[model samples]
Target: MVERLRYPGGLRLLLTPNRSLSWRGNVRIWLLLALVSGIIAGGWALAGVWFILPFAGLELMGVAAGIYVTSRNCQRKEVVTIEGDTIHIESGLNRKEHDWILPVRNTRLESFPPNTPFDCHRVRLANRQQQIPLGDFLNNADTDALVHALKARGINILQTEQQPTVGIWF
Candidate 1:
Protein backbone atom coordinates (compact mmCIF):
# COMPACT_ATOMS: atom_id res chain seq x y z
CA MET A 1 0.00 0.00 0.00
CA VAL A 2 1.21 3.48 -0.91
CA GLU A 3 -0.40 6.65 0.33
CA ARG A 4 0.41 10.28 -0.37
CA LEU A 5 -0.89 13.35 1.37
CA ARG A 6 -0.08 16.80 0.14
CA TYR A 7 -0.47 19.80 2.34
CA PRO A 8 -0.05 23.49 1.79
CA GLY A 9 3.48 23.52 3.12
CA GLY A 10 4.71 19.98 2.42
CA LEU A 11 3.78 16.35 1.80
CA ARG A 12 3.60 13.02 3.59
CA LEU A 13 4.21 9.68 1.94
CA LEU A 14 3.51 6.29 3.51
CA LEU A 15 4.56 2.92 2.17
CA THR A 16 3.44 -0.45 3.52
CA PRO A 17 3.51 -4.00 2.33
CA ASN A 18 0.29 -5.34 0.95
CA ARG A 19 -1.42 -7.97 3.07
CA SER A 20 -4.43 -9.79 1.72
CA LEU A 21 -5.39 -11.21 5.08
CA SER A 22 -5.32 -9.52 8.44
CA TRP A 23 -3.96 -11.34 11.47
CA ARG A 24 -7.46 -12.16 12.66
CA GLY A 25 -8.43 -13.42 9.26
CA ASN A 26 -5.34 -15.55 9.10
CA VAL A 27 -6.14 -17.07 12.50
CA ARG A 28 -9.65 -17.92 11.44
CA ILE A 29 -8.50 -19.66 8.26
CA TRP A 30 -5.85 -21.59 10.09
CA LEU A 31 -8.27 -22.66 12.75
CA LEU A 32 -10.70 -23.94 10.16
CA LEU A 33 -7.97 -25.93 8.44
CA ALA A 34 -6.79 -27.37 11.75
CA LEU A 35 -10.30 -28.39 12.68
CA VAL A 36 -10.77 -30.26 9.43
CA SER A 37 -7.38 -31.90 9.69
CA GLY A 38 -8.04 -32.93 13.27
CA ILE A 39 -11.32 -34.51 12.35
CA ILE A 40 -9.70 -36.56 9.62
CA ALA A 41 -6.82 -37.55 11.86
CA GLY A 42 -9.20 -38.56 14.64
CA GLY A 43 -10.98 -40.92 12.28
CA TRP A 44 -7.67 -42.62 11.49
CA ALA A 45 -6.77 -42.72 15.20
CA LEU A 46 -10.02 -44.49 15.98
CA ALA A 47 -9.10 -47.07 13.36
CA GLY A 48 -6.02 -48.00 15.43
CA VAL A 49 -3.59 -45.54 13.88
CA TRP A 50 -3.17 -43.69 17.13
CA PHE A 51 0.12 -42.10 16.04
CA ILE A 52 -1.93 -39.83 13.82
CA LEU A 53 -2.84 -37.68 16.81
CA PRO A 54 0.71 -36.61 17.51
CA PHE A 55 1.32 -36.03 13.81
CA ALA A 56 -1.81 -33.90 13.72
CA GLY A 57 -0.47 -31.85 16.62
CA LEU A 58 2.77 -31.37 14.75
CA GLU A 59 0.90 -30.27 11.66
CA LEU A 60 -1.01 -27.71 13.67
CA MET A 61 2.19 -26.39 15.16
CA GLY A 62 3.74 -26.09 11.74
CA VAL A 63 0.76 -24.17 10.50
CA ALA A 64 0.99 -21.82 13.47
CA ALA A 65 4.68 -21.26 12.85
CA GLY A 66 4.10 -20.41 9.21
CA ILE A 67 1.44 -17.88 10.17
CA TYR A 68 3.65 -16.32 12.80
CA VAL A 69 6.57 -15.88 10.44
CA THR A 70 4.54 -14.39 7.64
CA SER A 71 2.54 -11.97 9.77
CA ARG A 72 5.46 -10.77 11.86
CA ASN A 73 6.34 -8.11 9.33
CA CYS A 74 2.87 -7.42 7.97
CA GLN A 75 2.62 -4.21 9.92
CA ARG A 76 5.87 -2.81 8.56
CA LYS A 77 5.63 0.75 7.31
CA GLU A 78 7.75 3.65 6.05
CA VAL A 79 6.73 7.25 6.42
CA VAL A 80 8.33 10.30 4.83
CA THR A 81 7.24 13.75 5.82
CA ILE A 82 8.61 16.89 4.28
CA GLU A 83 7.66 20.05 6.11
CA GLY A 84 9.43 23.31 5.27
CA ASP A 85 13.18 22.71 5.32
CA THR A 86 13.18 19.49 7.28
CA ILE A 87 12.56 15.95 6.05
CA HIS A 88 11.57 13.25 8.54
CA ILE A 89 11.60 9.55 7.80
CA GLU A 90 10.16 6.91 10.10
CA SER A 91 10.25 3.20 9.46
CA GLY A 92 9.17 0.24 11.55
CA LEU A 93 9.23 -3.48 10.99
CA ASN A 94 8.49 -6.23 13.48
CA ARG A 95 8.04 -3.62 16.22
CA LYS A 96 11.48 -2.06 15.76
CA GLU A 97 11.47 1.60 14.73
CA HIS A 98 14.04 3.86 13.06
CA ASP A 99 14.05 7.55 12.27
CA TRP A 100 16.10 9.94 10.19
CA ILE A 101 16.06 13.71 9.87
CA LEU A 102 17.59 15.54 6.93
CA PRO A 103 17.76 19.08 5.77
CA VAL A 104 15.94 19.80 2.51
CA ARG A 105 18.65 22.11 1.28
CA ASN A 106 21.34 19.46 1.47
CA THR A 107 19.38 16.33 0.71
CA ARG A 108 19.65 14.63 -2.66
CA LEU A 109 17.67 11.84 -4.28
CA GLU A 110 19.78 9.11 -5.81
CA SER A 111 18.68 6.46 -8.26
CA PHE A 112 20.35 3.12 -8.67
CA PRO A 113 20.05 0.54 -11.41
CA PRO A 114 18.08 -2.62 -10.73
CA ASN A 115 20.18 -5.39 -9.26
CA THR A 116 18.50 -8.08 -11.34
CA PRO A 117 16.30 -8.36 -14.36
CA PHE A 118 13.31 -9.20 -12.19
CA ASP A 119 13.96 -6.46 -9.66
CA CYS A 120 12.81 -2.88 -9.97
CA HIS A 121 15.22 0.03 -9.69
CA ARG A 122 15.86 1.56 -6.29
CA VAL A 123 15.81 5.12 -5.06
CA ARG A 124 17.32 6.66 -1.94
CA LEU A 125 17.60 9.97 -0.16
CA ALA A 126 21.17 10.87 0.61
CA ASN A 127 23.47 13.63 1.83
CA ARG A 128 27.18 13.74 2.50
CA GLN A 129 27.00 11.50 5.54
CA GLN A 130 24.00 9.18 5.36
CA GLN A 131 21.57 7.54 2.99
CA ILE A 132 18.24 5.75 3.40
CA PRO A 133 16.22 3.58 1.00
CA LEU A 134 12.57 4.33 0.48
CA GLY A 135 9.46 2.58 -0.87
CA ASP A 136 10.95 -0.84 -0.78
CA PHE A 137 7.54 -2.44 -1.31
CA LEU A 138 6.01 -0.20 -3.92
CA ASN A 139 5.47 -1.21 -7.55
CA ASN A 140 6.97 0.66 -10.46
CA ALA A 141 3.91 2.80 -11.12
CA ASP A 142 3.58 3.95 -7.54
CA THR A 143 7.26 4.82 -7.40
CA ASP A 144 6.94 7.02 -10.43
CA ALA A 145 3.95 8.77 -8.92
CA LEU A 146 5.85 9.39 -5.70
CA VAL A 147 8.81 10.85 -7.58
CA HIS A 148 6.52 13.10 -9.53
CA ALA A 149 4.89 14.36 -6.38
CA LEU A 150 8.22 15.06 -4.74
CA LYS A 151 9.49 16.90 -7.78
CA ALA A 152 6.32 18.95 -7.88
CA ARG A 153 6.95 20.05 -4.28
CA GLY A 154 10.37 21.56 -5.09
CA ILE A 155 12.76 18.83 -3.93
CA ASN A 156 15.78 18.21 -6.13
CA ILE A 157 15.99 14.77 -7.68
CA LEU A 158 19.53 14.17 -8.86
CA GLN A 159 18.68 11.43 -11.32
CA THR A 160 15.59 9.88 -12.86
CA GLU A 161 16.85 7.76 -15.73
CA GLN A 162 16.91 4.02 -15.15
CA GLN A 163 16.77 4.64 -11.43
CA PRO A 164 16.62 1.43 -9.49
CA THR A 165 13.87 2.15 -6.93
CA VAL A 166 11.01 4.27 -5.65
CA GLY A 167 10.63 6.88 -2.85
CA ILE A 168 8.88 10.12 -1.90
CA TRP A 169 9.65 13.46 -0.16
CA PHE A 170 8.69 17.08 -0.56
Candidate 2:
Protein backbone atom coordinates (compact mmCIF):
# COMPACT_ATOMS: atom_id res chain seq x y z
CA MET A 1 0.00 0.00 0.00
CA VAL A 2 1.00 3.64 -0.20
CA GLU A 3 2.10 4.08 3.36
CA ARG A 4 4.53 6.42 5.03
CA LEU A 5 6.93 4.50 7.17
CA ARG A 6 8.39 7.09 9.51
CA TYR A 7 11.49 6.80 11.63
CA PRO A 8 12.93 8.88 14.43
CA GLY A 9 14.50 11.32 11.98
CA GLY A 10 13.04 10.62 8.54
CA LEU A 11 10.16 9.11 6.60
CA ARG A 12 9.92 6.16 4.29
CA LEU A 13 7.47 6.11 1.40
CA LEU A 14 6.47 2.73 0.10
CA LEU A 15 4.38 1.85 -2.95
CA THR A 16 4.09 -1.74 -3.87
CA PRO A 17 2.02 -4.02 -6.00
CA ASN A 18 -1.04 -5.36 -4.12
CA ARG A 19 -0.19 -2.66 -1.58
CA SER A 20 0.00 0.80 -3.16
CA LEU A 21 1.84 1.35 -6.43
CA SER A 22 0.58 -1.12 -9.00
CA TRP A 23 3.23 -3.35 -10.53
CA ARG A 24 1.21 -3.80 -13.71
CA GLY A 25 3.62 -1.91 -15.90
CA ASN A 26 6.63 -3.81 -14.70
CA VAL A 27 4.82 -7.13 -14.83
CA ARG A 28 3.40 -6.52 -18.27
CA ILE A 29 6.71 -5.63 -19.86
CA TRP A 30 8.62 -8.50 -18.36
CA LEU A 31 5.90 -11.08 -19.00
CA LEU A 32 5.62 -10.04 -22.60
CA LEU A 33 9.36 -10.30 -23.16
CA ALA A 34 9.54 -13.62 -21.36
CA LEU A 35 6.67 -15.15 -23.29
CA VAL A 36 8.00 -13.99 -26.67
CA SER A 37 11.47 -15.24 -26.00
CA GLY A 38 10.19 -18.48 -24.55
CA ILE A 39 8.03 -19.10 -27.60
CA ILE A 40 10.97 -18.50 -29.94
CA ALA A 41 13.28 -20.74 -27.96
CA GLY A 42 10.67 -23.42 -27.56
CA GLY A 43 10.02 -23.46 -31.28
CA TRP A 44 13.72 -23.83 -32.01
CA ALA A 45 14.32 -26.43 -29.27
CA LEU A 46 11.25 -28.55 -30.16
CA ALA A 47 13.55 -30.67 -32.29
CA GLY A 48 15.40 -31.60 -29.08
CA VAL A 49 13.05 -32.14 -26.14
CA TRP A 50 15.88 -32.39 -23.61
CA PHE A 51 17.37 -29.06 -24.69
CA ILE A 52 13.95 -27.43 -24.67
CA LEU A 53 13.41 -28.15 -20.97
CA PRO A 54 16.79 -26.73 -19.97
CA PHE A 55 16.30 -23.68 -22.11
CA ALA A 56 12.87 -23.08 -20.55
CA GLY A 57 14.39 -23.42 -17.09
CA LEU A 58 17.03 -20.85 -17.93
CA GLU A 59 14.41 -18.44 -19.28
CA LEU A 60 12.40 -18.68 -16.06
CA MET A 61 15.51 -18.06 -14.00
CA GLY A 62 16.31 -14.94 -15.98
CA VAL A 63 12.79 -13.57 -15.42
CA ALA A 64 12.99 -14.23 -11.72
CA ALA A 65 16.34 -12.47 -11.49
CA GLY A 66 15.02 -9.42 -13.30
CA ILE A 67 12.01 -9.16 -10.99
CA TYR A 68 14.14 -9.51 -7.89
CA VAL A 69 16.51 -6.77 -8.99
CA THR A 70 13.73 -4.36 -10.04
CA SER A 71 11.71 -4.78 -6.85
CA ARG A 72 14.84 -4.34 -4.77
CA ASN A 73 15.64 -1.05 -6.43
CA CYS A 74 12.22 0.56 -6.83
CA GLN A 75 9.43 1.59 -4.40
CA ARG A 76 11.61 2.41 -1.42
CA LYS A 77 11.16 3.94 1.98
CA GLU A 78 13.41 6.76 3.20
CA VAL A 79 13.99 8.46 6.50
CA VAL A 80 15.07 12.10 6.86
CA THR A 81 15.90 13.37 10.28
CA ILE A 82 17.50 16.53 11.56
CA GLU A 83 19.78 16.00 14.50
CA GLY A 84 21.67 19.05 15.68
CA ASP A 85 23.27 20.66 12.60
CA THR A 86 23.13 17.61 10.38
CA ILE A 87 20.40 15.98 8.31
CA HIS A 88 20.47 12.21 8.08
CA ILE A 89 18.69 10.27 5.34
CA GLU A 90 18.45 6.56 5.81
CA SER A 91 17.23 4.17 3.14
CA GLY A 92 17.44 0.44 3.20
CA LEU A 93 20.46 -0.27 5.40
CA ASN A 94 22.45 2.72 4.12
CA ARG A 95 22.78 6.17 5.66
CA LYS A 96 23.62 9.49 4.00
CA GLU A 97 24.14 12.76 5.86
CA HIS A 98 24.68 16.45 5.18
CA ASP A 99 26.01 19.10 7.54
CA TRP A 100 23.82 22.04 6.54
CA ILE A 101 25.48 24.38 8.99
CA LEU A 102 27.42 25.83 6.07
CA PRO A 103 27.85 29.47 5.16
CA VAL A 104 24.92 29.07 2.78
CA ARG A 105 21.64 30.07 4.37
CA ASN A 106 19.37 28.31 1.90
CA THR A 107 18.55 24.97 0.27
CA ARG A 108 17.28 24.24 -3.26
CA LEU A 109 14.76 21.64 -4.37
CA GLU A 110 15.45 20.97 -7.99
CA SER A 111 13.20 18.68 -10.06
CA PHE A 112 15.81 17.25 -12.35
CA PRO A 113 15.54 13.78 -13.82
CA PRO A 114 18.79 12.35 -15.09
CA ASN A 115 18.46 8.93 -16.69
CA THR A 116 15.74 7.87 -14.26
CA PRO A 117 12.29 7.79 -15.86
CA PHE A 118 10.72 9.42 -12.82
CA ASP A 119 11.32 12.98 -11.69
CA CYS A 120 14.22 13.22 -9.25
CA HIS A 121 13.47 14.87 -5.95
CA ARG A 122 16.71 16.62 -4.97
CA VAL A 123 17.45 19.03 -2.15
CA ARG A 124 20.50 21.04 -3.09
CA LEU A 125 22.25 23.08 -0.43
CA ALA A 126 23.23 26.43 -1.86
CA ASN A 127 26.08 28.91 -1.54
CA ARG A 128 28.98 26.51 -1.98
CA GLN A 129 26.60 23.70 -1.31
CA GLN A 130 28.29 20.35 -1.18
CA GLN A 131 26.21 17.82 -3.09
CA ILE A 132 25.46 14.42 -1.58
CA PRO A 133 23.39 11.73 -3.29
CA LEU A 134 20.51 10.33 -1.31
CA GLY A 135 20.00 6.61 -1.11
CA ASP A 136 17.85 5.09 -3.84
CA PHE A 137 15.33 4.36 -1.11
CA LEU A 138 13.15 7.41 -1.60
CA ASN A 139 10.22 7.74 -3.99
CA ASN A 140 9.47 11.01 -5.76
CA ALA A 141 6.55 11.95 -3.55
CA ASP A 142 8.49 11.32 -0.38
CA THR A 143 11.24 13.74 -1.36
CA ASP A 144 8.78 16.41 -2.44
CA ALA A 145 6.79 16.18 0.77
CA LEU A 146 9.87 16.39 2.95
CA VAL A 147 11.09 19.47 1.13
CA HIS A 148 7.68 21.12 1.43
CA ALA A 149 7.44 20.38 5.12
CA LEU A 150 10.88 21.81 5.71
CA LYS A 151 9.94 24.92 3.78
CA ALA A 152 6.80 25.33 5.81
CA ARG A 153 8.94 25.29 8.92
CA GLY A 154 10.76 28.42 7.63
CA ILE A 155 13.59 26.60 5.93
CA ASN A 156 14.71 28.66 2.97
CA ILE A 157 14.74 26.72 -0.33
CA LEU A 158 16.58 28.87 -2.82
CA GLN A 159 16.35 28.85 -6.62
CA THR A 160 19.32 27.44 -8.47
CA GLU A 161 21.09 28.95 -11.45
CA GLN A 162 21.33 27.22 -14.80
CA GLN A 163 22.66 23.70 -14.53
CA PRO A 164 26.11 22.99 -15.84
CA THR A 165 26.03 21.58 -19.34
CA VAL A 166 27.63 18.23 -20.00
CA GLY A 167 28.84 16.91 -23.36
CA ILE A 168 27.53 13.55 -24.60
CA TRP A 169 31.04 12.32 -25.47
CA PHE A 170 32.24 13.10 -22.01
Candidate 3:
Protein backbone atom coordinates (compact mmCIF):
# COMPACT_ATOMS: atom_id res chain seq x y z
CA MET A 1 0.00 0.00 0.00
CA VAL A 2 1.23 3.46 -0.95
CA GLU A 3 -0.50 6.65 0.17
CA ARG A 4 0.47 10.27 -0.34
CA LEU A 5 -1.08 13.37 1.17
CA ARG A 6 -0.19 16.86 0.05
CA TYR A 7 -0.76 19.78 2.32
CA PRO A 8 -0.50 23.50 1.75
CA GLY A 9 3.08 23.60 3.00
CA GLY A 10 4.18 19.98 3.12
CA LEU A 11 3.66 16.36 2.13
CA ARG A 12 3.10 13.09 3.95
CA LEU A 13 3.88 9.71 2.50
CA LEU A 14 2.96 6.29 3.84
CA LEU A 15 4.22 3.03 2.45
CA THR A 16 3.35 -0.47 3.53
CA PRO A 17 3.89 -3.89 2.11
CA ASN A 18 0.92 -5.56 0.41
CA ARG A 19 -0.30 -8.59 2.27
CA SER A 20 -2.33 -11.21 0.44
CA LEU A 21 -3.34 -13.02 3.58
CA SER A 22 -4.69 -11.48 6.77
CA TRP A 23 -4.21 -13.12 10.15
CA ARG A 24 -7.78 -14.38 10.23
CA GLY A 25 -7.53 -15.62 6.67
CA ASN A 26 -4.32 -17.41 7.49
CA VAL A 27 -5.87 -19.11 10.47
CA ARG A 28 -8.81 -20.30 8.38
CA ILE A 29 -6.55 -21.68 5.68
CA TRP A 30 -4.30 -23.39 8.17
CA LEU A 31 -7.23 -24.98 9.97
CA LEU A 32 -8.65 -26.31 6.69
CA LEU A 33 -5.31 -27.75 5.68
CA ALA A 34 -4.84 -29.33 9.11
CA LEU A 35 -8.24 -30.95 8.99
CA VAL A 36 -7.60 -32.45 5.57
CA SER A 37 -4.16 -33.64 6.55
CA GLY A 38 -5.48 -35.11 9.78
CA ILE A 39 -8.17 -37.04 7.97
CA ILE A 40 -5.63 -38.46 5.53
CA ALA A 41 -3.18 -39.27 8.25
CA GLY A 42 -5.92 -40.93 10.36
CA GLY A 43 -6.86 -43.12 7.43
CA TRP A 44 -3.24 -44.23 7.06
CA ALA A 45 -2.99 -44.78 10.82
CA LEU A 46 -6.03 -47.04 10.69
CA ALA A 47 -4.21 -49.02 8.01
CA GLY A 48 -1.29 -49.60 10.40
CA VAL A 49 0.90 -46.81 8.94
CA TRP A 50 1.01 -44.92 12.24
CA PHE A 51 4.15 -43.00 11.30
CA ILE A 52 2.19 -41.00 8.75
CA LEU A 53 0.22 -39.28 11.56
CA PRO A 54 3.34 -37.97 13.28
CA PHE A 55 4.82 -36.82 9.98
CA ALA A 56 1.64 -34.94 9.14
CA GLY A 57 1.76 -33.30 12.55
CA LEU A 58 5.34 -32.26 11.91
CA GLU A 59 4.38 -30.76 8.53
CA LEU A 60 1.55 -28.81 10.13
CA MET A 61 3.92 -27.46 12.74
CA GLY A 62 6.30 -26.25 10.07
CA VAL A 63 3.48 -24.49 8.23
CA ALA A 64 2.32 -22.86 11.43
CA ALA A 65 5.82 -21.62 12.14
CA GLY A 66 6.09 -20.04 8.72
CA ILE A 67 2.75 -18.30 9.11
CA TYR A 68 3.72 -16.95 12.51
CA VAL A 69 6.96 -15.49 11.24
CA THR A 70 5.31 -13.87 8.25
CA SER A 71 2.52 -12.31 10.31
CA ARG A 72 5.07 -10.65 12.58
CA ASN A 73 6.24 -8.28 9.84
CA CYS A 74 2.99 -7.82 8.00
CA GLN A 75 2.24 -4.57 9.81
CA ARG A 76 5.52 -2.89 8.89
CA LYS A 77 5.21 0.69 7.64
CA GLU A 78 7.35 3.60 6.45
CA VAL A 79 6.12 7.13 7.11
CA VAL A 80 7.67 10.31 5.68
CA THR A 81 6.67 13.82 6.56
CA ILE A 82 8.13 16.99 5.11
CA GLU A 83 7.13 20.20 6.86
CA GLY A 84 8.78 23.59 6.50
CA ASP A 85 12.55 23.08 6.41
CA THR A 86 12.52 19.73 8.12
CA ILE A 87 11.88 16.16 7.04
CA HIS A 88 10.90 13.44 9.46
CA ILE A 89 10.94 9.73 8.79
CA GLU A 90 9.51 6.93 10.89
CA SER A 91 9.56 3.24 10.16
CA GLY A 92 8.49 0.17 12.08
CA LEU A 93 8.78 -3.56 11.53
CA ASN A 94 7.91 -6.35 13.92
CA ARG A 95 7.23 -3.78 16.66
CA LYS A 96 10.66 -2.14 16.35
CA GLU A 97 10.53 1.55 15.38
CA HIS A 98 13.21 3.90 14.05
CA ASP A 99 13.13 7.60 13.35
CA TRP A 100 15.24 10.18 11.48
CA ILE A 101 15.18 13.94 11.30
CA LEU A 102 16.82 15.93 8.51
CA PRO A 103 17.02 19.60 7.73
CA VAL A 104 15.42 20.22 4.37
CA ARG A 105 17.97 22.79 3.35
CA ASN A 106 20.95 20.56 4.08
CA THR A 107 19.54 17.11 3.34
CA ARG A 108 19.69 15.47 -0.06
CA LEU A 109 17.58 12.62 -1.28
CA GLU A 110 19.45 9.81 -2.99
CA SER A 111 18.05 6.84 -4.81
CA PHE A 112 19.91 3.62 -5.47
CA PRO A 113 18.99 1.00 -8.00
CA PRO A 114 18.33 -2.48 -6.79
CA ASN A 115 21.36 -4.76 -6.70
CA THR A 116 19.47 -7.42 -8.60
CA PRO A 117 16.55 -7.33 -11.00
CA PHE A 118 14.29 -8.95 -8.45
CA ASP A 119 15.14 -6.60 -5.61
CA CYS A 120 13.29 -3.41 -4.66
CA HIS A 121 15.04 -0.09 -5.22
CA ARG A 122 16.06 1.99 -2.23
CA VAL A 123 15.77 5.68 -1.36
CA ARG A 124 17.71 7.50 1.32
CA LEU A 125 18.08 10.91 2.90
CA ALA A 126 21.60 12.06 3.63
CA ASN A 127 23.67 15.03 4.65
CA ARG A 128 27.37 15.46 5.31
CA GLN A 129 27.15 13.68 8.65
CA GLN A 130 24.69 10.83 8.22
CA GLN A 131 22.40 8.92 5.92
CA ILE A 132 19.22 6.98 6.59
CA PRO A 133 17.43 4.63 4.21
CA LEU A 134 13.65 4.63 3.66
CA GLY A 135 11.02 2.52 1.93
CA ASP A 136 12.70 -0.83 2.11
CA PHE A 137 9.45 -2.62 1.33
CA LEU A 138 8.24 -0.31 -1.45
CA ASN A 139 8.24 -1.51 -5.00
CA ASN A 140 9.97 0.33 -7.84
CA ALA A 141 6.89 2.31 -8.85
CA ASP A 142 6.09 3.49 -5.34
CA THR A 143 9.71 4.50 -4.76
CA ASP A 144 9.71 6.46 -7.98
CA ALA A 145 6.45 8.14 -7.08
CA LEU A 146 7.91 9.11 -3.72
CA VAL A 147 10.91 10.71 -5.35
CA HIS A 148 8.70 12.61 -7.74
CA ALA A 149 6.52 13.83 -4.89
CA LEU A 150 9.54 14.99 -2.93
CA LYS A 151 10.90 16.81 -5.93
CA ALA A 152 7.55 18.44 -6.47
CA ARG A 153 7.73 19.80 -2.94
CA GLY A 154 11.01 21.56 -3.82
CA ILE A 155 13.11 19.11 -1.85
CA ASN A 156 16.68 18.72 -3.10
CA ILE A 157 17.27 15.37 -4.63
CA LEU A 158 20.82 14.15 -5.24
CA GLN A 159 22.11 14.38 -8.83
CA THR A 160 20.09 17.53 -9.44
CA GLU A 161 22.03 20.62 -10.45
CA GLN A 162 20.47 22.60 -7.62
CA GLN A 163 22.43 20.58 -5.06
CA PRO A 164 26.18 20.07 -4.91
CA THR A 165 27.33 16.60 -5.77
CA VAL A 166 28.04 14.51 -2.70
CA GLY A 167 30.21 11.45 -3.04
CA ILE A 168 28.24 8.21 -2.73
CA TRP A 169 30.92 6.86 -0.40
CA PHE A 170 29.07 8.32 2.57
Off by over 4 Å in 3: 5-9, 94-96, 159-170
User: What lDDT score is found at residue 85 in candidate 1?
Assistant: 91
**Residue 141 in candidate 3 has what lDDT?**
91
Candidate 2 Cα misplacement greater than 4 A, ranges: 1-48, 75-77, 83-86, 92-122, 125-129, 134-143, 160-170
Candidate 2 C-alpha lDDT tens digits along 1-170: 23455656443333232323246766776788878877877787776654666767787778868776666555444444544444544445223322233321344433443333433545543444455444334456655665566565444565444355556643
Given candidate 1, what's the lDDT at residue 76? 86
By TM-score, the candidates rank as 3, 1, 2
In candidate 1, which residue ranges exceed 4 Å CA deviation? Answer: 6-8, 94-96, 158-170
Q: Write the per-residue lDDT of candidate 1 for residues 2-96, one digit (tens) a residue.
A: 68866677789888877889999999999999999989999999999999899899999999999988888677888888999998999998553
Model 3 agreement with the true structure over 106-164: per-residue lDDT tens digits? 98888777654556767888999988877777788988888898888787877422223
Q: Estimate candidate 3's alpha-carbon lDDT, on a 0 to 1 scale.
A: 0.83
In candidate 2, which residue pairs clash?
1-19, 1-20, 9-80, 9-81, 10-79, 10-80, 11-78, 12-78
Please report how far candidate 1 places residue 130 from its true position, in Å.
Answer: 0.5
Error of 3 at 26 (Å): 1.2
**Local distance difference test scores for all models:** 0.82, 0.51, 0.83
Worst 10 residues of 3 by lDDT: 161-170
Arranged by lDDT with the best first, the candidates are 3, 1, 2
